[model samples]
Target: MSASLSVGARDLPRTAARRVADGLALAAAPTFALMAILVGAGGSDVGQMLCAGEQGLQIGGMTVMYMLMSVFHLTPWLRLIQSGKREAA
Candidate 1:
């Protein structure tokens, strides 16, 4: 039982890391597409403003989402560490 539990625990972090990486890739795709379009459109002032605003929002939103997801992914580890410290105390 302890061995199985240890194996499960080891798998958990790797699975969570894969999920976070997948999520980052998913989040980045649209941002990259938008950037490509913006670049191809030739930075006329109007085009620049429009694309800049749109890309800014998209990238910023993705950045925030990534940060939140990262925090969420770390939460379990953090809790485990804190609990360990408490137990040690």
Candidate 2:
């Protein structure tokens, strides 16, 4: 009975988190598209942006930074998922 009651209590928070996730997912596409359009319009030698002597590469910097930041952003969701799996077991 308590477990079922707790499940009912969990639904509101889960629904709120789902809404936040949906919002971020929805926002991602337009943000990416705008960035792509701006980058495309501002034409440079995109190839040379990541060459042997081009300070390692513009893209390389962005990739490094994104990965570094993603760890912090993704860790919470990973823990949440793991906990859900544990609960199922």
Q: Over all chains combined, what TM-score does candidate 2 have? A: 0.41
Instruction: Give lDDT per model, in order.
Output: 0.61, 0.59
TM-score of each predicted structure versus truth: 0.42, 0.41
Q: State in Å the error of residue 61, model 2.
A: 15
Lowest lDDT sum, 10 consecutive residues, model 2, at: 52-61
Per-residue lDDT tens digits of candidate 1, residues 1-89? 99999999999999999989766655554555555445434434566667667433333444455545555455455655798999999
lDDT of 2 by residue, 1-89 (tens): 99999998999899999989866755554555455444444434656545634542234444444444544455456666798999999
Q: Show the colliding residue pairs in model 1.
A: none
TM-score of 1: 0.42
Candidate 1 regions with alpha-carbon error over 4 angstroms: 41-89
lDDT of 1 at 69: 55
Q: On a 0 to 100 scale, what is the lDDT of residue 67 in model 2?
A: 43
Model 2 spans with C-alpha error above 4 angstroms: 1-5, 43-89
